[model samples]
Target: MELIQEVMIMYCTRNVTEDLVWVGGNDRRLSLFEGVYKVPYGVSYNSYLLLDEKTVLLDTVDKAVGGIFFENIEHTLNGRPLDYLIVNHMEPDHCAMIEDLTRRHPETVIVTNAKVAGMIKQFFNFDIDSKLKLVSEGDELSTGKHNLTFIMAPMVHWPEVMVTYDKTDRIPFSADAFGCFGAINGALFADEVDFYRDYFDEARRYYTNIVGKYGAQVQALLKKASAVEISMICPLHGFVWRRDFADYIAAYDKWSRYEPEKQGVVIAYGSIYGNTENAAEILACRLNELGIRTKMFDVSVVPASEIVAATFEYSHVVFASATYNGGIFVKMEDLLHDLAAHNFQNRTVALIENGTWAAMTAKQTAELLGKCKNLNILEQKVTIKSSVKQAQNEDIDALAKTIAGTF
Candidate 1:
């Protein structure tokens, strides 16, 4: 008889602490996140494994990467049984593997709040009465050397969302609060990567599109967070934060407050042909000439998520659209509606409309923006009939001057 050799391949895992291991995987093949936003760089589903007197698992990966995630968890455990599964957020991406995990680790007790306990039953049809360890705000649980505290952060994009604080390690398992979109390649911590250059835009896009509407809720959460002493942040997605925690917290504070991060202009245009685009281009040129930092995007081409992120980053916004069917162009209309839905406010806005017949884009745009909060809609509405000729130059220049003057 010939003996056959078997090769066992272990999944990728990273150490977050002496005992805590990152048992998560990246979805590089995914084209979209949440079946909506485009994720070209892919997204990470982060789960943590803590080996202690009582082993605990922090969150779980999405079902798409369930096999690899399990492999990572098993490898990190090294045959040790999981004692507790700490669920920080009940979103499907982070909780989809809960049933599989429970089936495998039959003795594991789920530690979460009442709201999440109900959600688990609703999502997985599992009986939450038997193995659930319910926690509340400021509730503490000890797993040998580590003491974990739960903090309720309702409507931080989800009503059942909560963060876990490790008192022994001074680490906060912040759920999706500080998460970004990009996959963690070799670098697992924020200090390991060029975050501002590589991941900042995606982070902003992620927050603005996913959690922008709940600014007040985020503010409340931030207020609670300020009272805690957080040394490291372990979010459910993207890289972990072991250093420069203040900068990330400040960024979140500004975002939750609807305050622009920088002084600049974002000119987004929806043009049927080239007329409206031409007007936008001309205005962009004027702004640039006047020493104002400007960014231009064709609303028809760019995704609304990116535009929303840009609107959040910049202090000023310019909307130029061609009137279509007696209204603003559909692409621009969609962007405006998204901005409003995200609770966009506290910015200076300039309107430009182009039409061959009835020019209703400017009026419709103004009305839509009027519904938002603290928006300074410029009174100098530039109307372009068919195209921008030399006659519209003075109006364009005036609008540009007004926008530049605000800077």
Candidate 2:
């Protein structure tokens, strides 16, 4: 007699929508707050297993976690062989395990768009065309009960990116459009997890860090998504959204639009000495007194990723920096560059410069911000004179008033 592990039957994968499924991937906890870069709260190499008589596996996990992904697929299939493997994005993390999966199931046919086929050959060196079913943007794959419709999502974080929607189930399995790091423990669906406690911030972090540069393209993608009558969003990673899924979609739209979230102030300051720091603190307190919510971020200490993430949360941004060699501080420069690359739109930005002799951070930051369309800069700038003085305190207060009034 052969020993067997406990069998797992899945109605649908945890993080996926209806006919689409989220089979595996996502780390827990680390993606919550900030600490390090390169290694995000761990990452989930999400894959989906779509079962409807003739089974299809959408994407594969990273090679490092291939074994786990196989386990999830096997558990879902219950010994049923995979008939098709759809390649949505060819990023190594999502496609690394494809070779392994194909080796196990030689009969599986690979389906993908033309550009993705080239990527597969470049990375895997396999002649996929012979066994590949090339599909277009509106191609459909029927699996008895579900009809999977493919939509092209160019520059939606990647050039070869695409999404699959199941009309029968009213679910969309977006490749990475709404993905986030951090696992939702055992909870499978979006409604099962605590959105306020877990999913909200991480989703913003993922968007800002990974796909911030493609804000305009995202707006177009959202318009495309609107055409579909979707009730659930099963992204590649994180939990599946089954109930009130529109809320998540709306949130993504707002962030990508670079619209402000309520009336609040974000003070991101980078100070070599304590002078700029003092200015930021004063600004925070002054804003508080005006009955406005204020959040402070030390650019030197805060990860650029977190600062990017926070941009999606607040309406107004107050950038305070000490001048370094007649320019913005290095950290502040990096933050501004990242923000500008994302086409920071709709938000109001205020500047605070601290320099003993040449006050350059304010001018430089303003010039950099000018490149971003629709970014409103406060006319009144708070200049800290090397040291915190009584006069500087008044300037900070006035700056706070401008931010509050803009709201």
Candidate 3:
């Protein structure tokens, strides 16, 4: 059947090549691109209906869209009644409709792991008494024609998270794996979208912003996923992956490893005035002249989240800032504080500071570097005399050398 492109509606239809029904959401939030926190492409709250002899519903969307989600559920079930609802991730965005679902289909069993059950109780405050079926790692539950193998993915962003694999369908119900933040109108498979150019960036942005802190755990999950025979990935967000599934896995693999996108130097400056920005631009030019690709961000203009995300994607990060009241700008401090908390890994950092009398940024910025894990700090520091000088040309040259050598 043909799919329609309408906004803010949840509907259901069977995958042309698979037995699973796409239900739940493909709604877009208009406010999703208003600012730094807004993920421009929005997101999809995906759920699935897999029918054999027994039926399984993968996940649900937010309570705000619970009505539409249930509408999709009703349309797909056609009064046969759902047998199971698989709670992949316990995050409210995907699990908010669980309560309503349970109330609607009182006989439907909730399938999840021990940790997830705890979260369900904690989040919903319901004594689900006897309605829970707990599965652990490598555990398989059979429903006649199809078998679901549960793989525990702790800290693939959350502790209670697990992925469901239907071996018969060769599909992995990847709770949050291979997910992006866009709402698809009519598309089902990822290959239907321009994933190479657009979706990949959204996926990376999602990973860096949400799951970057759990890089090690993601790597472990990726390893586990690699061992499975998966032809499709039905994540809780964005498009479903049927064809080119390996590419998404490979993309996640690279992201978890903190691999650089390209040989580029990111010159991030926290400028109090135009002074520090001037230094950054000059340094970028020098790096460019030396055949080194450079991307510059004014920490004031670009968000701290974006900076951290880009920093993880670059081999070299150079921070330029003006000292204010004997310290680096509050914004810069906040950025450094966040970077430290996330254990900013796998990058070389260089510092540039400008201050009239106190000149505290160089030392303070360098001190902030100590908070990050696996961070390599270049030995040379660029100190400005409240302004740029001809002698400062050597500092840019030195910065270029540091980046070239590290990359």
lDDT, each prediction: 0.91, 0.80, 0.80
Worst 10 residues of 2 by lDDT: 29-38
lDDT per residue for candidate 2 within 101-199, as digits (tens), equals 888888899988988888898888655777799999889999888888899998888898888887888877788888876655667666777885766
TM-score of each: 0.98, 0.91, 0.92
Top TM-score: which candidate number? 1
Compute the lDDT for candidate 2: 0.80
- The positional error of residue 168 in candidate 1, measured at the CA in angstroms, is 0.5
lDDT of 3 by residue, 163-224 (tens): 99898877888888777877776787777878878777667777777778887899998888
Considering lDDT, which of the candidate structures 1 and 3 is the better prediction for this target? 1
What CA RMSD would you report for each candidate? 1.2, 3.4, 4.4
Off by over 4 Å in 2: 1-22, 27-41
Backbone clash numbers for all candidates listed? 0, 4, 1
TM-score of model number 1: 0.98
